[model samples]
Target chain A: MTQQHKHIISMLVEDEPGVMTRISGLFARRGFNIDTITVGKTQTPKVSKIVITVKGDDRTVEQIEKQVNKLVDVFKTIEMKDDESVTRELCLVKVSLSNEKAKTDIMHYAQVYKAPIVDITPKSAIIQLVGKPQKNDAFLELMKPYGIKDISRTGTTAIQRGGNGEK
Target chain B: MKGSEAIVKTLIGSGVHTTFGFPGGAVIPLFDEFLRFEGKIKNILVRHEQGAAHAADGYARASGKPGICIATSGPGATNLVTGIMTAYMDSSPIIAFGGQVSMSLIGNDAFQEADMMGITLPITKHSFQIKKANDVVPTILKAFRISAEGRPGPVYIDLPKDCQVGEVTKEAPKKVDIPSFKPVYRGNINQIKKAADMILAAERPVVIAGGGTIIANAAKEVTVLMDTFMIPTATTIMGKGIIPEDHPLAIGQVGMHGRKAANYAVINADLVMAVGCRFSDRITGNTSSYAEKAKVIHIDIDAAEIGKNIEVDVPIVGDSKSVLSDLIVVMNEKLKKKTETEWSKRMKELNQLCRCNMDSKKEPIEPKKLLFELNRILKTDDIVVTGVGQHQMFATHFIDRMKPRTFITSGGAGTMGFGLPAAMGAKVAVPDTNVFDIDGDGSFLMNIQELATLKEENIKVIPVVFNNSYLGMVRQWLEIYYSKRYSQVKLGRHSDFVKIAEAFGLGGIRVEKPAKIQDALKESIRSKETMVLDVYVEPESNILPMLPPGGHLKEAFGGCMNAKGVFF
Candidate 1:
């Protein structure tokens, strides 16, 4: 039997119109579900990096990687292994300041997690959190008791740990 | 120069002698330029845009050049979707051009405007929309390059009406630069060496080839490798003619309706070397039980296809022709030729068993018997194209294609209307070669309008229709799986096909009896004009040696269905 696990796939693609659609369309067409995806320009002006996370058996994930690599716009596709890469996700959470005790508890949790309070109003406070997706998930869970109002997240993005940064 | 003239000049400059297209409002400027440069390119006007697309696909499959098809935007471009998908699935090279409305009115959904690039993106290798007159030459040239290179497929170009009418000064580029689209042609030396060693060690080895063999022109290389090692071979329908069916080691095609010997060979082989073939589900029914004993070595030009369908022990990514050449060299260096083995003897016995009732003399002609007659009549190099149905399977069973590109069909897409126009396109590509479309009543009617195109173009080809009066393949499945609870599969015989052919200004022959099939075929071939032979065949007959849907290879059934509705 094969085991299913999360796979972080990164690609260097041409910075052209519809490149994102081409990438996402391929995943949809091939029936590979994307758990989360993030894209941004690389150091090279003409190149963009796309990071996608999908959960599948190793074989299916490998097939997805090969299929994505076949697109003409893609230059390279690599699996960003958890051990050899640093993955980060930025999330913003808005929490309701229900009471003095609730606000103090929320501030204590934010400090412990190193999440800075970016905005504070009379009734609500917006905290910015940057960490691994799982750590952010834990942070969201802690803020739930403080009456979480809304949330925004930039999905997981990754780079290799050392000097070679996805050439 | 006008952009229309630039487009025409680029086509001529790219060594395109013929193109299939239909004129409409958006493409008037482009159509006018065909008259301006009269003798340089032959523009064959087709009845429908779908016909244009299929004709182009057929031409590409036959001539190994990228087939060109042009259509106006909106409905015309949308009509081409099926044919483009057919070419896309089979990896046949075709360049499809759709004339859009003016650039300014693109987003407004102007009359006769369509998003050709957006529509064709999933089906084509690449697509481009020319933004201005100056971009026409370069984009068209790039489309041609992309279509024919690597694993060849359709490439679509959206030509706005303004771009076609506007003036252009730019010259055609000397070379196209696509930095991210390089295709690997040569296999890794280490992998090639490993494959050769594996072949040498195995006692029961089978080579399964597919459409990529024909696309790469690697039939000779494949044949040489199998012959040198005394290996029996089977082919997918797409790879039908890659190996001459008459060869001693050939076990015939392997699939749902494949030969028993071929399926048996694949199931029992200790080593399976799949060359230029994607293991489609039809080829490997019930994947868990398919070739469970075989150590598979898959070779294909596309890395994505290597393990897309089936797992492999060794995967070599390279063009079939190049990889096979290297494998042949490496194998010959360290090995001595082995004579006929026990496996070959068993293959011969199985083949003989499979041929028991193929020559049956029945009243309403047996499907296999009709093909047996066709097998006797057709020349080795004569091209035979078939639409999807019972007749196509019968052709696959009995057609003895001795050359590459001789047996063309919509293998992946299974498009019903592909035969007639595709045959016409093959004839256009190789005018001297005799081309024939072996079709069914159901499949023939789907593209019957192409008969007008045939009459107009004066393209000489023969069409043999097995008039079963029903969607025979679907009806057979209904009978088998649904306990004979038939549905809308019956296409009642209401119209006279022979009269229909005559109405199109072509000679028509009707063959009702088994004995008349030969003379009807002979007369059609002897006649210089296009002829249609409407051969009325056994209506209730089902294709045999069929593996029940999702059934294992070892469980495939042959012979007739019994009174209890079970195949014996």
Candidate 2:
């Protein structure tokens, strides 16, 4: 079997209704595993940027990119290399305080991670962090022992790490 | 002008003179517009919306123009899904218009409303929902352009009730520009040169023409290449009729249930130039073993299809006619002489050795015999459309189609019930040509409801039904692959098709003996009205030279057999 890796594919697509489904449905129909997908309006008024992270072998990923590019609404598709691209995720975690000592420890750890407390209650505090997905994962691991109440995450979105922009 | 009127005008302006449709509540306003423009556009009302879609697909395949179909909302639109997918799989150019509830009631679970855009998005080349009246003309025009351009496929436009009734003010665009959807029409010069070099160096070369050849109208170019190079040629099922079956260089249809000579040539050839073919599994059985000895050159308009199924040594992405024309020019300049080589002699011997006995004096008629008789009487201009089944395979094996777009079948989707309506669509497109629907009992019954449409519309289509009263193909599979433990394969003698045909006020005949087959076909052809000839074939007969599903093409068995029960 060929070696498989998590691939990040970014695309510029027409801002048309059902364009997202057209893109995502292709992956589903082809049975490719999509790890995460993020979409937002681009600077161009009638276009949108979509970042999709999928797990597949090299050949399959190449095929997926070609198939995605074939969609009528898609303008272009490019692979965002890990070493040459900036990738980030936003994660919000609500941790149960339980005690003052625990709360101080959590706050200290939050400050070290540069994660700010966005909401606070007598029993819980919501820590909001925007960083690389691995960093957010590490923070979540540290909060596991504090009796975490809940967590929400925005899937990883990426851009090229250079002076030039993708057309 | 109203939005519906603008739509009618746009369709007429686009050179669409015929459309197939079934009306319902949501499309009442649009149907009224069709009424007002009755002379300008002839809308044939089909029994079912699915029939409408298939008929349009058939029209497109026959006429080489974009076919149009319409249906009401919800169930009506949903019924078109199968036919739309069929056209999509075959890459036929068709535009389907579906009605939707009023825009205000769209998301509120309005009566007779369905998410047509969502339902058909995956199956269509593109789909649009007319949000307002102003968008109607442009959307319809764009739909036609998109469906007919770039590899050609079905495009859908959903019309809401308000949009149909609303006023249109803006002028329709004279041309459509889609930035994201450009198709490459000329192959890379370097690649074309490489392909020419390969052809020159090849000791044995074979050409596999496909549906793309017909779409590109590259049959003449393919013929020139074959004659110039003295190469044997084979065609995929969709590619049938591109080359005359009786041409000395022709090796017949290639793939599962294909001719022995065709499969044998591909297996042994040193160079395989596949033009306008996607190498579907039906064509390239056991992909790992397919064309193992050949350095494959694949030329197609769709780049994605080139490498999707089979690996190619020389990949040329362009229109087949354009690419072949360039390749021919390069070859012509480089060639010193053209003569029949040892490879061509071997191919001729192989073709001669693969002939089967089509004349049997048995009581029950063999399906092959029926097709042989049909072939004798069929004019070069006559068209034969088939449903998917054993009869389709027999027709593929026996029928001799001498022109492009002469043999139409549901190749990719293999949709049964495609014959009747598709034949109707073809007859509509070419009234002067004789259109025959060669169907099986199992397949013909699937869309027998179209007999009424034939009677009312006066479309003269001869339905040559091979009525064995069994799903013969599946039964063959059961006998060979399974333990002959037939399960639900038999549709016992319950329905009388002659009575059924007469019920629709059409002519019908049942031919139980071999001698009556030719006369029945002749009678049907002579009649001005539609006639159904339900032929009783050998009950347990099977279509052979069969490659078991996923088996190597070279290993195809059971066409030529002696008393010893061994293949040649």
Candidate 3:
């Protein structure tokens, strides 16, 4: 059987066109499916940081990390499974509140969860919640009894908690 | 100026003529601006934000243009995530503009404030938050370019309320200056040469084409290679119609529920030239055993997909059309056609055997027969879209897509409700062309709400529902491996789809008899508005030629055997 392991990869690269294409293309050529990828600008101008989460064996991930780092625009690439990282996700949920009683009940739950009421209409109220994915999920389950209508969640984003920010 | 006015102007400047959205508190100002610019930019007020997202997706898929959708902060924005993920999976270009809390209150737990950027990061190709109104124009331009460029997917832009209301004294940048965004279009010569050499040396070679080929418009180049080398080609679900199904080199689709001949050829081949395909698990059943004897040469535009699932012996990264062209050039220079008459003969025999096994009875309305009849009625230029599940597999198996863009289905995501809206978009894209959405009863209801959108747009699309009254795919699994637990697969609740269509002010027809299918379809096609033909199918019917999950492609069960061990 093929060995499978979860890998978290971090990269510092020049922010430009087709870089993502090139990076994703490298993974595609190797037949590597990216489980998750988060890209955002760093504090410095013209630089972006990309965190890619992949599920593969250690050897495969090492090979992928090496190939990715060799790309001209990539400044650095590091596998983050060994590093301390802070992962966060955000979610917004709409709860159906047909009457004032349901609305007030939902507000009380929101207060307990520290979720803010974002939008309120006579029929429904939207709540904004941000935390680890598990926390958001727990909050959503708590609200489910109140008649949740819809949910939107961002998968996951990670940053090194406290380490060499630059590679 | 109000934030709403800035958003409207940015949309107009981005060349968005139509937008789908619902209003909320955070976006009330934007809705007000939408009213002011009602004539300039058509704002569609969908019943739900989810519907708005699907409508935008439909518009984008049909028009080959980026579809735009708007939603307020929190729930309204979150509702668009499903649509966003759907677009992302299918590689459709769409722009989702989400309302955000004011910048000052972004992390203060203010009203209508949700972290839109963080929430949509995984599903979106890229996303941004506007800190000032001046950034809106440039951001819109960048978002459009990113969403529509090579291997197009969905992008998002979150507008904070304060930024939309802020002043913009300077003009937005005419163009973005990201140097790292260039996609590699041309194939590397050495890699192309190595691939060509391998193909030339192999006695039995099969080509697995995927959605990337269609996206890259590489069909012509693929045809040249197949014809020159007499290589048998099979397609992924997304790759249907990239080559005419009737072409001699075409061996049909491969993987779970794929054609037996196609799977056999892949397993027996000395070399597998996988072009523009990701080798999704649906196509490769058992990862360790798949193509065990073959040298796998995987070529794709997206480098990340190359060895993620299946390892490759030789990898080439570039646009499918360009890479195939270069490979062809090298092959023409260094190689001669190597004939494998015995292998070809065996393949033909297997194909015949599989077809014979799948051939169903003429009476009591066979699903395959329906597909054949639909194929017979369709013009070569007509477009066909399918909802996910058994019906989707059946359509991909039987339909003859002779032209490019003739077959449109949600392949990657396999989103259930994608058929109707996508068909609507296809019709809107090619107004003169006929488009049909072949759907399952279970899948159809997921987006049946879009029936109203079709009526409002006045777009004509023929919807043929295979009313099996169950989730046929799941039911098939339960029957084969799960002891027929049934679970929630049965559609016990009554839903008169015909009546539902009528409720939406569209044409409706119900076909109980096999003989009525043609007439019902013809009438629906002739109708000017959206039409639904709810055809009752066999309740216990299962899609045949099944390769059980994790089973070798070669180990296919011909069909469901009766109690007497007789194949259906």
By lDDT, the best candidate is 2
- Every candidate's lDDT: 0.89, 0.90, 0.80
Judged by lDDT against the true structure, how good is candidate 2?
0.90
Better candidate by DockQ, 1 or 2? 1
- For candidate 2, give the docking quality class from DockQ: medium
Per-chain TM-score of chain A in candidate 1 equals 0.97
Candidate 3 C-alpha lDDT tens digits along B1-568: 5556767887787777778888887777777887789788877676667777766777777566898888999999998988899888877899998988888888887877777776776577777778877777777788887788766789888988777777776666777854545667787889898898898888888899987888788889888766667788888888887887776668788999787778888888999999888888889999989999999999987776778788899989888988998888889888666455676656655555555323444555678778877977999888898898999988988787976678888788888887887776667667798889999999999889889888887878999998888898899889988999999899985468999999999879988777788898899888988889988877777787788788778677764232112212
Question: Which one is best on DockQ?
Answer: 1
Angstrom error of the Cα, residue B9, model 2: value is: 0.9
Q: Candidate 1, residues A51-153: lDDT per residue as tens digits?
A: 9999999989999999888888899999999999999999999999999999999999999999999999989999999999999999999988888999999
Give TM-scores for every candidate, taking all chains together and pairing residue i with residue i. 0.97, 0.96, 0.78
In candidate 2, which residue ranges exceed 4 Å CA deviation? Answer: A98-105, B562-568
RMSD of 1: 2.3
lDDT by residue (tens digit), candidate 2, B201-312: 9999999999999999998889887777888999998888888778888988899988888888899899999999999888988998999999999999988887788888
Writing each residue's lDDT as its tens digit, candidate 3 over A17-104 gives 5568768877886688997777889987988988888888776887798668545468778777545777776788999997788888
